[model samples]
Target: MHDNLIVIDGLQYSNWNRAIFEQLKSGGVTMVHVTIVYHEQIRETLLRIGQWNRLFELHHDLIMPVKSTADIYLAKKLGKVGIMFGAQNCSAIEDDIAMIEIMRELNLMIMQLTYNNQSLLACGCYEAVDSGVTRFGRQVIKEMNRVGMIVDMSHSGERSTLDAIEISQRPIVISHANPSSFHAAKRNKSDEVLKALGESGGLLGFSLYPFHLKNGPDCTLDEFCDMVANTADLMGIDHIGIGTDLCQEQPISILQWMRNGRWSKEMDYGEGSKSDADWPKPLSWFKDSRDFPNITQGLQARGFHDEEVAKIMGLNWLNFLDQGLQAQKV
Candidate 1:
């Protein structure tokens, strides 16, 4: 992997600290969209941002906030990792369309309408019936578009996902998920959705989450790379990138929070087996921020041209963010 290539992870939520920051630097990761909230409401979401502020101060040398494409370049120039905020669910905005602008001002650039369950905005993939985007979701999407906040549907149901792509004037995204043809996990998207996403000029960031991979933790680099290649043939090469969904160093209890939150008293296993409550093992080739070069090498071995590999590794995401984070012109 060339150190000059702008490597960006489209989505990640790690137990961040100096060690992870250093690993990201060593891996040549210029920018990352970090998940700021899943189920937290407005106040708790603000607290999460406050915690990130503290992290920025504490790790000033290794990481910095990314508010624009200019900041991505600045991170490269200064040899620091650029961090951008995102929410995996719309709970942070909590039924208010105005809050979309507020969150954007605070630099929450991407938000999913649902997170494995029905929400005020849309239906999640886990729902038996997908009611699609609600009237409120349409209003929120417009507000998000105007404010330059991205509508991400990685966890949304198919109808809702398609509806978002059609209704939003600007392109939306699926920041982290795999094709259902590769793996049938509820979190994985379908070919129909991928086709609609590409046709609408949106992007899909392939997930490295175990449940979404073809064979869970045992999936080979070849299998993963081949899947990317196949998906590119289905979608356009420009519409695909890496969103590893890396939940590094998080405890098993955190998984409970992600899957259940406050909605259920009973435990939810999510994609894991009912008895398995632990994080599935990551692929041997790409386990952490430091292992990113392995993916570049895998792409190269799979015969991707240097330019195509570069785009998949990061440049495409940079372009997407550049467009998605800027307020719409009148």
Candidate 2:
């Protein structure tokens, strides 16, 4: 892997610390969209932003906040990792359309309409029947488009994801998920959704979460690379990138929080497996952020040309965000 190549992780939710920042720097990761909230309400989401601000203050030399694509370049030039905030669910804005631009101003650049259940915006992948985009969801998407906050449907259902693509003038993203054909996990997308995404100029970031992989943690680099190749043929090279979904060094409580949130009285194993009570074993090939280069090398070995490998590694993400992150011209 070339050190000069720009690498951007489309999504990650690691336990933030100086060490993780150091790992990203060592991996030559130029930028990452870090998950700031899954179920946090407006106040709690603000607190999360405040917490990240503190992390920035403490590790200013190793990491910096990325408010734009320009910051990504600056981070790479300075050898620091750029951290951009994302919300894994719509809870951050919490029923208020106006909060979209406000959160964007606070640097929450990406947000999903749903996590794994119905939300005010859209139906989740786990739902029995998808309602598609709600009235509130339509308004929110428009506001998000105006303000440049990305609409993510990584955990949303098929109808809802397709609805979002059709409704939004700007291209949305699936920040982290795989194709259901590759693995039948509820979190993965179908070929129909992938094709629509490619047609609408949307991007899909491949997930590395164990459950989303074909064989979970034991999935080999070759297997993973093959999946990428297959997806590229389905969605085209420009619409795919790495969004490893790496949740490193988090405690069990956090997993419980992500899965259950506040709605469940009983434990809700998101994938309906009791074994999901604990984090699935991490992939052996990708133990941490420092292993990002392994993905680039795997793509190369899987017969991706240098340019295509660069696209899958990070260039696709950067180019997609270049337009999507900008406020719509009225």
Candidate 3:
């Protein structure tokens, strides 16, 4: 069933090409918050932003750039998927707070404090010592709030996430995260963090990565929906949404590079031992962006009403964006 819903994806890192765009269109995605940074590929990040801009210009009918909630509403009206640029790592800012506004003007709507390791702003979940949000991180959060970019805490450590939530004037988002209660992975957020997020009026996009699910690599769409529904039931449906961290079409070389932590500026590829085995095995169900429909259908089969399903799919994100954009105006 084609629902005329304001569907928004919290995070996607696929290899952006015509094929993926077509698939997104087929899936009825109204807007997508796509991460442009991971670890420290500054050059690659710039190139990807240009590519997305070109896509917006070339495929104007299929996609548009989203800088605010109003843009998303316009895209929905026009039946186009709005591309909301986000950075998964502060490394893109390269220790410069001024770049935050520059990137925001370029339509980078959301930014995670760190990727999966320590940075100038915050420590990631995988760090051996959780250092929390640094002084520079406080500056970053203030600038982000001032400039109207959504503060994302998906891969940030527990301490860092809490600090961000406390300091941010605008509501932060765990753009893509799973509950530690279900999966004890370092990448998953603790129940305490989830509660704080809800209390802070932020949103949590339940991730669909297999390792974060109860069934791990063997998880089905049903399992994914149950996890999200459970999170919604606990955190309040208004604060839950979809942030499928899908990397289906990414090059295997990129995956290998990320696994080695070569993408981080702090880690030396040769000196630091590889940790490819620790990386989660990609799920069989995550074939491409087109599989988004399966998630919607699965939620329907699980007995969610149309309004609840719509909220889980995208309305929740739309509402969160509206709050952030409104904060920007104030």
Superposed Cα deviation of residue 43, candidate 1 (Å): 0.5
Please provide the root mean square deviation of candidate 3 (C-alpha atoms, Å).
3.1
Candidate 3's displacement at residue 49, Å, is: 1.9
lDDT of 1 by residue, 1-330 (tens): 558689989999999989999999999999999999999999999999999999999999999999888999999999999999999999999978888999999999999999999999999998999989999999999988998999999999999999999999999999999999998888988899999999988999988888889879889999999999999999999999999999999998888899999999888888776877789988888789898898899999999999999999998898888999999888
lDDT of 2 by residue, 1-330 (tens): 658889999999999898998999898899999999999999999899899999999999999999999998999899999999999999999988889989999988999999999999999998999989999999999999999999999999999999999999999999999999999988999999999999899999999998999889899999999999999999999999999999989998898899899999998877636855788898999999999989999999999999998888889999989998999998
Name the lDDT of candidate 1: 0.93
Error of 3 at 86 (Å): 0.2
| Candidate closer to the true structure by TM-score (higher is better), 1 or 3 | 1
Off by over 4 Å in 2: none
Expressed as tens digits, the lDDT of each residue in 1-330 for candidate 3 is 545767788988877777788888888898888877776545676787888778778888788888788898898888888888888887778868888888787777788898777878989877789878999999989989988888999888899999999999889999988898878877899988998898889999988776567777788777777777778777888899988887756665666565445644554332123554343566666656677777788889998898998988898899888878543555
lDDT of 3: 0.80
Summing lDDT over every window of 10 consecutive residues in candidate 2, give the lowest-scoring window: 268-277
| Clash count, one per candidate | 0, 0, 0
